[model samples]
Target: MHKLTEIIKYSYNLNLLYVEDNDEVRNSTMIILREFFKNITVAENGQEGYERFTEQKFDLIMTDINMPKLGGLEMISKIRETDNEVLILVLSAYNEPNYFMESIKLGVEGYLLKPINMEQFLVVLNKVIQKVQLKEKSRTYMSLLGQYQEVTDNSLIVSKTDPTGKITYVNDEFCKISEFSKEELIGSNHNIIRDPENPKEFYEEMWESLKGKKQIWKGTIRNKSKSGKSYYVQATIKAILDADGNIVEYIALRSDITDIMNQQKQLEDLIDFSIKPILALIEIVDYNNLSKFYGHKEISHIETVFANTLLQSVPNKKLFDTVYTLSHGRFAFAKDANNQDIDEIIDNVKKALHNVNSSSFEIDGKVFDISIRVSLSYGDDILENCTYGLQKIKKGHSDFFIANGLAQIEKKQAQSNLNTLEMVHTAIKDSKIISYFQPIVDNKTKEIVKYESLVRLITPTNKILTPYFFLDVAKKGRFYSQITQIVFNNSFDALSKTTKDISINLSALDIEKENVSNMIFDLLEKHKKDASRIVFELLEDENVKDMNVVKNFISRAKKYGVRIAIDDFGVGYSNFVRLLDYQPDILKIDASLIKDILTNDYSLSIVKTIITFAKSQNIEVVGEFVENEEIYLLLKELGVDYSQGYFFGKPEPL
Candidate 1:
C-alpha cells in the first residue's frame, strides 16, 4: 500500500498521453489515468497520439494495439523514431502471442487486457515510475561525475593496471611524468618504471597491503623515466574491487614530487659537506639601501660589477678556491689554510678588497664608487664566525672586522627554535587549534554546495595564524596529531548545525595513528545521521607509512556514508592504480593547476583529462583557487562540477 501510494504521488507530477478508438474503453481507462495523473492528454486515434507527443513531452503513453487511421503499434513505432525514453503501454483484447510479441517489439512498458484490472494496472504503473525516476537520477549523477573527472584527470598522474599488475590505461599526466608514451605503457608491467633502488622488501610490503590484505598501499617511490632519468613520486596503490567485493584490477594515483625530493637531497648534501677554513665575507655597504636610488635591474648590475672587480683584483686566484654569492649583496671567499697561515690568507683577501673598494665600477652606462665591508675568520666554524663578524661590520662604523672565536649566532638560533616550540605547546594546551570554513561553489549553479575546513591556529595574543606559520614547529614538537584531532572534531561539530556538507583535511599520517583513527570512527558512529554529509579530504603532501591502515579507515568511514576526497591533486604524487584502493568520492584539484589553467596549456590539458577520468569513475571534482569570475566561468565551460577559493569567499568562521 505504501509503495502504491508513493508511485501515485510520483505519477501526479508526470504528464501522460492516452490514445484509443473505442469510446467505452477510452473513457473507462481515462478514469483510471485521471486518478493517478492530473495532466493527461487524451487522443481519439493513433495519428492524434503521435501529434500530441510531438507537441509536448510526456512521461507515459497508453494506446490500443488496434486503432483507426493508424494502429496503436504504428503510432508507438513512429514515436520511437523521435523518442526512445518515454514509457509506453498497450491495452488491447488480443490474447495471441503474435500480438504480445508485436507489442514487445514496439517497446511497450506493459500490455493489458481490454478490461483493465485495477491491481494489475497499479503494479505496472509502479514499475514504470521506478524506471523513469531511476533514469532521471542516473542522468544527473553522470553529468556531475563527468565534470569532476575532467578536473581530476588533468591534475594528477593517473594509471590503471589489470589484476596481475599489467598496465591497461594511463592518463596524459602519467605519460608526461613517466616519460613514456601511452603505447609503451599499455601492455607493459608496472615495473617498467620501477627504480631498482627500492628494495625487494618495499615491494613485498606494498603487495602485502594491496594484494594480500586487500588494502591501499601508499608511500614515496623512486621511479625511472623512459630515458632512465630518476624521479620521485608519492604513490597510492589500491586494488579495484567489483560489486561482489572481488579484486578486479588495480589503479595507481601519484603526484610528482621530484622537485621536492631533489631539494631535500641538495640540502642534505650541503649539510654533510665540510666547510673550507680561512673564510672572508665581503658585502657592498648599504647594498639594500641602494635600491632607493637604483632600479632592481640596475642594483643587480651593480652587484655583478662589484663581484667581478673583487675577483679580478685578487693578486693570486689560487688564494681563494671558491667565491660564493650570499643574499643581500654579500659574497664569501673561502680556501684551506694548509701551509699558508690565517694572516697570510687574510692579508691576500685584504689586498683584493682594497683594490675593489678603490676602483670605480661601471654598471650599465653609469659609473659609481662602491665601498665594501670585509670580515675575516679562520679555524673551526669559519662560516659562522665570518657571518657574525659581517653583522658587526653592518652595525658599527667600520669597514673591516676580524673574528677570533665562535659567535653567539648558534645560541640565538637555538633560542628561536625553542621559542617556536614553546608557542606550539602553548597553543595546543590552550585548545587554540581551530578550523576555518571555505565555501565550495557549484560551477554551473554558481552556488555554495559545501565548505572545506582549513586548519588555523590562534596565538596567545588572540591573533589567528594559518598553518604555514606553526604547523612544522608543531610536528617537530609531536603536537601535529593533536591539531588534526582538534580540527576534525570542530568540523564535525560544525557539520551538525549546517545542512551543507563539510570537508575536513586529513593526511595519511593522521590515519596511521591509532588514536586519531579511533576518534574519527567514534565521531562517525556518534553522529550517524551527519556521516553522509562529512567529507574527509586526504592531503597528499606527506607519505603514507602503512597503506593498509589508511585504506581500512577509508573503507570503514564509507560504511557510515562518509565521503573521501583527494586534496591538492595534480600538483604531485597521484596514481590512478591507487585510486582503486581509496576510491575517492571527490578530487580537489591543486590550486597551482587551477590558478594557471587559463594561461598555461599544460594546466588546462591536465584539468580536462582529470574531468574525463572523474566522469568515468562517477566522482565529483572541486577546483581550488578559483579567484575570479573569468576562472569560474572557464571551469564551468570545461565541465568542472565545483570550485573553491577566495573569489567565492576566503576561509571564515562558519
Candidate 2:
C-alpha cells in the first residue's frame, strides 16, 4: 500500500506495455498495473508486444524473458536498433549468468526475479520511473537546442568566443564567407575581418555592453574579406552564461546583406520608366538561405543567372525588359507595353518562368531545387497592384490580376463581404440559423414523400432571410463549415420530431473537406435509427474535383442506410457519366427543364430521356419547379415519380 501511493504520485501519467506468455500472471499483474498507470496495453507474447510497440508510443516496456515466438532479450535488441530511450524491465524465473549478461547487453533497465517480491519490485520500478522523468526533461531541452541549431545553420553566419574575446567556434558559413579556414579563425580576435568604416565610439559601446554582460546586442557591421572585398552583416551577439550566472562565452549570429544593399539602386532605376510597366513579382517559397548550401559567391552568381533568365524569357524584350533584385529570395521585372498586348505577354512569361522554377540545378556536385510564387500586374500603378496580387496569392487565391476598374469593384465587394461575414458568424454562434422545410410529393398520390431542409437566417429586426442572400458570403470566408453544421443539427432535430423523410443539401466543398465530411458521419451516427430517412441532396452542377472522396463518402453513407439524391440534374456539368459513376438513389430533375417542359420540345425530350434512363437504373426521378396543374398533370402522365415546387408547397418554417 505504501508503494502504491508512491507509484501513483510519480508514475500515474505514464503508459506501459506488459508482455507475458502466462495468462494467469499477465491478468493479475495487469490489474495491479491498472491501479498506477493511466494506460496499460497487454500482449500475450514478445512478438505481439513488439507489434504493438511499433504501432503506438509507450513510456515503458515490461516483458517475461522466456516468452514464446520471441524472447525478451531479442525484442529488446530489435527495439534498440531504432530507439534506445524507452525504459525496459525484464521478469524471469531464472537468475542464471547467461540471462543476466544478455539482459545487460540489451540495455534493459531492470531484471527482476519472478515469483515476485512486491517491495523489491517497487524499489526498482521507482528508480526506473525517476530515470524516465529525467529523460523527458532532457528530451525537451534537446528539442529546443535542435531548433536553435537549425535556424543558425540554415540562415545565419554563426560564431562563438570566450569571455576574453578569443574566438572559440566558427560555423562553416562564417569560414566560407570570410575567406578564412576554421583553424585560422580559432584563437584569433573577432577584429580579423573588421573594416575601418565605423568610428571608434561604435567599438567602445559594443565593448561596454560585453563587459556589463547585458543580454543581446544588435547592429550592422562592415567587414573586409581575405581578398580585400568589403561586406556588411546584420549581427546579433549574446552572452552565454554558466550555472553560476557568470558569462562563459558569447555567441553571434549574422546575416550577410551586402548584395541586397548593392542592388537597391538598380531596382529603383528600373522602376523609374514612364511607360505603362507590367510588373511580375517572383518570390522564393523554400528559401532557407542559399548561402548555407552554397558559398556566398556561388549564390550571388546563381541570382545573376536567374535574373538573366527572366530578361531573356519575358516576351517582347526589345520593348523595354528590365530585371532587378528587390531583396534576398525576391525579384521584380518591368516591361514597357501597350494595353492590348499585355495579357498575351504575361501568359508567355508565366509559362517560361514556371519552367525555370520547376527545374533543379547542380552546383559543386550538390543539387539545389527551387519553388516560387509568382504574381503579376498590368497597369500604371504596377508596384502597388503587384503587392496586392502577391498578398492574394499568399492567401491561397489567384496569383495574377489586372488592376482595372473591375478589380477595384471586386476589392470593394471583398471588403463588404468581411462585414457580412461577422453577422453570419454571430448567427451560427447564437443559433439564429434555422431550417425551413419544403415538401416533395408523389406525382400520382400527391402525398408528401419527403421534405427538403433549407437554411434561413433571422435578422436582428426579426426578419427571415434565405440562403441565396448569405451562403456565398459564408463560402468566401471561413464560416461555411460552421453554417453547414448548424443546418445539419437543425435538420436532424426536425427529422427526430416527425416520421417524414428529410433531404439536406451539400456542396462539393463540404465533401472535399475531411472535417465537414466527418461531422456529417457523426450526425448520422447520432440519428442512427432515422438515418435511412435522410437524403443528401447534392447539386449535380457542382464540380466534383476529388471523385475518390465523394465515392468513399457515398459508400460509407450507404452502409448506414442513408440515401443519396442529385439535385438540379439537367444543369451545368450533368450527364449520364456522372450518373453511372455515383449511382444515386434519386435524381431531382433541374427546375429549368421542368419550367419550360410544356412549351419547349427540347426540354420535353431531355426530361423524357432522363426519366427513361432513370427507370432503367431503378433510380426514381423527381420533377422540380412544377408550378401549375397542367405541368403537374403532364409530369404525372410522363411517369415522373416525384414533384416539388410552388405547385406542391413553398418552403416554410417547420
lDDT leader: 1
What ranges in model 2 sit over 4 Å off? 1-382, 386-411, 541-549, 572-577
lDDT (Cα atoms) of all candidates against the true structure: 0.79, 0.78
Clashes of each: 35, 0
Worst 10 residues of 2 by lDDT: 572-581
lDDT of 2 by residue, 1-654 (tens): 246687788778888998899988878777777777878888888899899999999999989988889987888888899898888888887756567656766777766666665655676678678778888889886876766577567656999999888999999889978999999999999888888787899988887776663658888788998787998887889998764357889999887878776665565555566366576777766554444455445566677776766667555666445667655577876666645587677777686567667687654576767666777776655666666666677677544444434356557877788868988888887788989999999987999989999999987778888988899988877788788888899888888677889999987557866678899999999989889999998865436766777888889999889889988886532233466456699989989989999998767866875686577667898998989899999999999999999988999987
Q: Give each prediction's root-mean-square deviation over alpha carbons.
A: 24.3, 22.6
TM-score of 2: 0.46
Q: What is the lDDT of residue 176 in candidate 2?
A: 77
